[model samples]
Target: MTSLTIPSPGGRLASTVVAMAVRQRAVIGDEVTYVVLDRQWQVVEPVEAYLEYLRQEQYSLNTVRLYAQGLASWWSMLEDGGLDWSRVKVDDLARFKRRLRDRGIDSTVITLRPEQTAASSTVDVGLSSVLGFYRYHAIVTGVPAARQFYEHVMGGTMEARSRYASFLGHLGGGQDRRVIGRRREPKGPPPFLTPQQMKVIKDDAGRLERGTGWCGDLRLRLFWTLLEETGLRLAEALLLRHRDWQPGTGTTAFVEVQPLEDGRRRLRAKNQQHRRVYISDELDDLYGEYLFLLVELGVDVQDDLPVFVNLYRGEFGRPLRPETIYDWIEGFKRRHPLLPSRWTPHWFRHTHATALLLAGVPEHVVQRRLGHRDIHTLMTTYAHVTEDAAMRAAADWKALVARWGATA
Candidate 1:
């Protein structure tokens, strides 16, 4: 549908079929299968092209899957409503937004999460994805109508017209931008484990008896420690390899974070950059112990093997999945009365970033440590820290003012 055709000398039926075994997987883990297209390139055909475009741009698989789903869902909605793709208007886009905002969304359309609220935050997410799909087609094929709908309706720009114009298609990428800050209330800072709670949890994890058959509590602790110390994303830490870690001067080490680039098995880093994190000897030793446990369990200690693997779950040597840790953490919170029910692996990242900033680490340094591309991103998350610091400074100023008045 997006115009990838290899014309054959033997006519249409004699075309060679490209084996999919060697086809690149979508940056999204699960890529979509190609659908047969009609002579016209409208409707769903562009969806395939748009997905491939995402993969080419190195968009993550999760991102690609969302675009694919959003587009396909919108396409189905269009077909059912007897609407023409080329003829879609700004008002139609509003209708789609309302439909997504309504309760009782068809399970087939979207699988809602507990955290997903109706009408605003979650609905905006869907609208963004769907709008992205249209943007993809507009940018790719330079479709004027699609671009107009995206800019006018979705971007909150001017509306589409009734009569056709003999003008050029979507001319500029900057013509439209996503409308933001319209939420009823902005989200609060990410939750984090308190220092006291972290210690208690670490003690509980440290006291894990390998004999109880969970041999991986120490491994979990190591994972958590890496998050706390390094501020590495959970996925980055999970996909770590033995070779990725480097030993440094007395009681110190560094963990290399690389874009594992090629395989679906070892996905690329979220930020897709190569960086290293300093590690303490204590954590390095914990890592060694975890490795030794893996060896004791007859798991291979190859340099390229994933650092974290299933220890008790029947799938033994397979890389430990996030869901496993999520469930484990949930159960852990249940077992230990001190741990917060809302605490998660990601919270460690927030906790680490906050700790570093409040400890007087420079913003640029914290940004690099957290693998954030922009210092503004770091500033945005920790803005509350800045405000608190300012408030404390104001108190000092007040004290100085009082002293000056007394002297006067």
Candidate 2:
């Protein structure tokens, strides 16, 4: 690791000004893992330990990489402040939060408010990672300074539930602790594609070839269809295998989203949790058509092979990548002006949930279909849908009351 030092503001001290970086290395037999390097270019032991613990606890590789990046930012902050990692205080963390918020401002420009460089939610993610690092060290190594970052509060108290339990504690009873200076984020609905927009995008993805029944790019078409219909995450859909597709009796079918470890890439399903997402019979027929197209192209299909693979581009038969999907969306948006300005693959998930709620589906049923471990997440995320539903019912209440009066 190469290290560089720059003199501090008043030339009073030389501080490491270089930011830390994350690297991937093969540990055992094609299995890959991530490690963080400090500004001085040495492995950060605490971060390495925490990442390993996450891996052992079955956290996805993408999640591990994300946490590593956050911790890397923390290490850079510590170096910039010339502060020791082990001796950081609550005030230091607050400063760190400010630094993150002001990350992209131009030094030459002078303006109040700093133009809001980073979103509050993004800063919160970084802070959460840093706090989790300290929390791990405090519990495992009994580091006194690390323990100072949190305040233990009794369970069943409002503050405890709202603060401590939300962050680091188990639900429903016991003493818990929350990190100081963790910002409260606003609750809002996630963005989703409208039905007409989804239809246009899917139709544009793959068109039927003239004089032939095959679509131009069946693989890409199938991908958008799967996400739109089933609400699968980008990674979850990418990690799907041929065997995971279960064709039920007489036109019914479902796809099982499993936590498969792909040795080639660090791709895994989010949360490493298993759940089945049912698909429409039309989608089932689409899958079969895609298979037929695969055979025509001389690409062999197998049960263990990834469902979405690169048939038209790099490394035929290799798993489709999340980067490729993002690139596709970028080009797609350029071609189509009707899509939402801030549309994303995640919008399919939001759209799916919103549609279900609006169609009068029970919250719990939607929760199960979406593979949420509990209904709380479902309720919190789609609360806007429920609230809108209530308002509509209130608007129709006069007619409802009149009907009841006449019946009586």
Candidate 3:
């Protein structure tokens, strides 16, 4: 048997806690809990260690929750197969994949999670989490079989490599070496709005009013206007303060997306990176009018005031929630029977990416504007845009070559 070693006090402590906790669980008869986790997101063996590792790695709570659920699904499969997780062979992992595909979905059996009818994407996430669990244990808990198992599962041996530009480098932490990541090809381009659908949605937004009332709410208009123009993640827009607007940056205006670190519903961009978003001058003027409207409604027009706020009954000054914005969009969809059932507020983001690509904006520029960590992400998400862009590029090259060939 080969031995594994890690030279870190924190790593050893985490392993010890996880190992002891599971053994104690047998004596305690389930009284020994592994943190207060949602049923579907519960971890099995090494729960504390894995969770602690994620905490140390600075994964967000929401990110931790999804990762936990994926691990929980893997554990459930292991229990059904009656196999020890630590001793998992490649064949066992292959069998798990086959089982998931064969079962498809057992609605009655899968109650805790949404895997009842989960797509291929969900299955892939589960597989990734299981692999990650093995790799982590192999490194931190000194389990040699785990290293062998990780290689077998990967179907290839991994090479150690240097990784510069670490996120926690400033704190003198974060891994300087990382396993080469393996992400399966995306299942498909996400459902997005077409130019026609966007035009329709925009027209509808322009005409929105308070339910059953003749009065037009400027807040309602500004909310949709900001979302459409800036392509903000709903939470980013929801938590926007008046001070975020940095007007007059040489014929354009920019808004700063600040983090909502200390709130019940914490708000951050998907990347958790601060970004500057430019909006049309029209939107800038509209915001000015919206601020005046807020003042008229006896709401404070201060820098700290939320751009979108609850203005009904007792909840008047509270910042609006993403869900509330979604609800309003849903209501709009219902009222306009012509609206596509597949349309969601997020389609605006997709549409924005598509429109930018179609209009010949450089992908990197669009990527930066949208706060995408990778330009490849935008290219993948808007494959249709890229395809068209590719064709146009080919045509331009062909014309240039034809002129040169004729002269030669």
Best by lDDT: 2
Report the lDDT tens digits of candidate 1 across residue range 1-408.
Answer: 123457667676444432111112233454333332222333355666766666677666666555555455456556557788767886666666655555324434555453343657555555666666666656567788887776665465433443322111222233545443224457787676666566666766654566674443777788776776677887798888889987555634788898754344434579788886776666777787787788788998888988888887848888777778778777778898666777777887887776665555678877877788899998988888656775343223333223212111
Order of candidates by TM-score, top first? 2, 1, 3
Residue pairs clashing in model 3 are none
Q: Against the true structure, what is each candidate's TM-score? A: 0.73, 0.80, 0.68
Q: Per-residue lDDT tens digits of candidate 2, residues 204-295?
A: 78867778765557788898888877878777888888999987577458888896776456677765678777676678888888888888
lDDT of all predictions, in order shown? Answer: 0.62, 0.70, 0.59
Could you tell me which 10 consecutive residues in candidate 2 have the lowest summed lDDT? Answer: 399-408
lDDT of 2: 0.70
Give the Å shift of residue 64 in candidate 3: 1.7
Error of 1 at 257 (Å): 0.8
Q: After TM-score superposition, what is the CA distance of residue 332 in candidate 2 from its true location, in Å?
A: 0.9
Tell me the lDDT of model 2 at 125.
70
Give the poorly placed runs of model 1, Cα more than 4 Å off.
1-43, 103-119, 154-184, 208-216, 249-251, 261-268, 389-408
Highest-scoring model, TM-score: 2
